[model samples]
Target: MIIDFHSHIFPPPLIAARDKYLSDPCFRLLYSSHKARLAAADDLISEMDASGVNKAVIQNIGWASHDLCVRTNDYLLEAAARFPARLIPFIAVQPLAGTKALGEIERCAAAGARGVGELRPDVQGFGLGDDRVIKPFVETVAGNNLVLLLHADEPAGYAYPGKGAVTPGVLYPFIAANPDLKLALAHWGGGLPFYALMPEVGAALKNTWFDSAATPYLYRPEVYERAADLVGENRILFGSDWPLLGQRRCLDELKALNLSTQTLNAILGGNAAALLGLE
Candidate 1:
């Protein structure tokens, strides 16, 4: 029961009219290049079959515009409905939209959205630590029993596309403030799990999970072992960041690390299953 915790899919129409979406800075930064791949739900299903992934969470990139977020959320919900067994939709929302964003989340939760995520707070013009700005949104997500996945990046790393300033410093306060939220920080929690070595940080992150979305591009393979040692195997999730990274390629790389079968299995699926309440 292997699950890729982070992946993205677009509607065919959105992919066809990619130019129109480029007006959003985050979209423009990631998709302006012709080489950057834009995959649809069919593409994800095909790749999952080839990679032996049983299920995947469909992520939406941060869109500053509420209209863009809603448009993409509709597509995510539709795609998940079309392939209910294989896809889990994590709808997107521009938290700055206030009540409207909460309404969209309620609507999607009723329609079958399992989570809300891949949120890029920096690009979305909100600080994760800004309780006044995001508390309502956070409350709404929690009320719906939806996991919140935030985009996190290493604060000191070389710049890359979509690498905004949602680093550990910014993420820690939010985690402390909302200790009860089921939070999954994408991209290895921007290296936040490493901080779990500190007693206080570790305590605050009891409910947090980290997804290895594009780890091959970021760290050495030893990261899997090191992160597990610091935060335990249950806190790590296997996320290929599909389209940006291949499912098979990432799996092969992790497999090469020669981790024990138990540890490997936990990261690959066990942890995510428990987190998502999958049977």
Candidate 2:
């Protein structure tokens, strides 16, 4: 029951016309170079097979263009439909799009989207803490019973592409405010779990989860044990951020950790299965 809780897949046309999408600042930051891998559903399925993954949550980049967001959301839904047992789809929306964004979320939820995000508020032209602007978007996600995954990177880390400003400091208030949203912060919640050592911060994170997306590049292997210690094992999800990193490689790194089989199993899939309500 190995479940990848975070991964991205683009439509073939989008990958083909990568240059066209580069006009969007976020997309440009990530994929401006031809070396940056852009995967389609087929690529994901193949990687899953090779990595022994039973299920994967296919996500979309937080596109600045509402059109790209809609188109990619459709592709994720279609991909999940095509591989019902193997893929779970999470829709993308530019929350800054106002009612249109809410409309996109409702349409996708109706079409079977289980969640919303890898949202990059920094690139999407908003702040998660901007309640006046983001409250409705967060409300819509919660109302529809969907998990929200936000792109988070540690503020103190070495600079990298796509690492716009969302950090633990920025994410805490939002997490505190939206206590009911099933929020999964990508990239180890930009190291937010570490702050959970603080009693108040831990209390505020009652409904939050963290994913190890791109962790191999960001932290040492001790991160898993330390994060679990601070936030508990159930709060972490296995996410390779595949295409950016390999599933097999991520799995290998996780397995190499000196963790109990029970804990390892929980991180590998049990937690995500429960989070997603998967049988």
Candidate 3:
């Protein structure tokens, strides 16, 4: 019952037009390499099979440019439909799009998108702290019963491709505003769990969850045990950030943690199933 909480895929057509997407300044900045890999649905399923992952949540990114966001999203929606059992769909939206962003969400939801994100406000050009810009996006997601998975980066960690400045300081205020939204922050909330030591901050995180996407890129397998200890096993979701990382590689690292069976099951799949309403 292993469910990967974070992964990405693009349509074959987009992959075919790699040069166009790669030309975007922001895309080039993050990808930093023309050789960067983008997986298609088939590639994802094969990796999932090889890694023993039963299901995966495909996270779409809100590119800095609105048109790219829409194009990437269109491909993601179709891919999810093509492999519904193995892949759950999520759409990307530029909060700066205002009403248009909300409209995009509506379009994807109607087409059967289960959630919204891999949202990178830093690269996407919207400050999570800017309520005027981001409120509509959050409201739209909540209104439609969709999960919110925002990208988070540890402020003190080494620089890497796609690392954003969405640290706890920038994201916590937004989380506080939407207490009811079941938000999952990728990359262990960029070390947000450490703030849970503060009595008041811990109380504000009642609805927050953290995913271990690309753990090997930044930390050791002990991160799983440490994060679970700080935030409880239920707050941790297993995520491979596949293609950027690898599902089998992430699982192998997790296996080294020697976590208790219950905790392991909760992080690997149970928590994601509950969050996603997979039952």
Candidate 4:
């Protein structure tokens, strides 16, 4: 089964008011400059059906506002519950919310959230390098057996809408310190695999993996094979940051890479299946 590990959705009402949300001072940070297609869960289902994507993890962004986070996460939880077989819900909590965020995590987990993420520290305003700020949330997620996914930015990539400044440098310190945290860094960890040649960096990366969400816009399609060689095929997950880019875009790009069927299978679905405990 093809499991697209990264995607997003909003409630129909929210999607209908996309222009307003895109213009809101806070939400504008991610959507002001770019007007990409935003979909409701039902739209996502239709895309999945058309793309032949068997399942997808619905990623809610880390909203700095407590109210926004809860609103989006609530929809994700309900959508996942309504379509248990097709959607795996992942909630994003603002670390600034402190106890409230923890409570939100608890509530979502109880409601069947499989993970925590689409976390954008750059946008949400937190230092992942600071253990104190995120430790409680990390521990809560770990304690609950929920995977963590963080949005990533290359220190040198061209600027774009929703691009955050969580460079690999910032990611290294925290990821190294918390070896037990299960992490999947979106956008191929901002080209971090290339640094895996460094022993210490490679060691610190044992528990982390990279996802190819919005990859075509960031790098050449050959990056899929190149990254696999540097980080191992097992550490790559198939994540199409859908709506921004079609699921078929990533699928077609990867298929043209001429990789072995075993490696292809791993990138296409097996790796995410194992990480997410999907059958």
Off by over 4 Å in 3: none
* Residues 1-279, model 2: lDDT tens digits: 899998999999988888988889888989998989999999999999999999999998889989889998999999999999999999889988899999999999999999998899898899877787799998899999999999998889699888878998999988888889999999999989989989999999989999999989999988999999999999999999999999999999999999999999999999999988888
The better candidate by TM-score, 2 or 3, is 2
lDDT (CA) per prediction: 0.92, 0.92, 0.86, 0.87
lDDT agreement of model 3 with the native? 0.86
User: Per-residue alpha-carbon lDDT of model 1 for 25-141, expressed as tens digits?
Assistant: 889988998789999999999999999999999999889998888989999999999999999999889988889899999999999998999888888888876777688898899
**TM-score, per-candidate, Cα-based:** 0.98, 0.98, 0.96, 0.96
Error of 4 at 237 (Å): 0.4
What is the lDDT, from 0 to 100, of the residue 244 in candidate 4? 85
How much lDDT does candidate 2 score?
A: 0.92
Instruction: Give per-residue CA lDDT, model 4, range 96-152, as digits (tens).
Output: 889998998898989999899989887788888666778898999988889999988
The clash number for model 1 is 0
Error of 1 at 137 (Å): 1.0
Question: Which 10-residue window of candidate 1 scores lowest in summed lDDT?
Answer: 124-133
Better of 1 and 4 by TM-score: 1
Model 2 TM-score (2 dp) = 0.98
lDDT of 2 at 189: 91
Q: Write the per-residue lDDT of candidate 3 for residues 60-163, one digit (tens) a residue.
A: 87677777778888888888888888888888887887788899989998998889998888877778778788777788898898999998988896888777
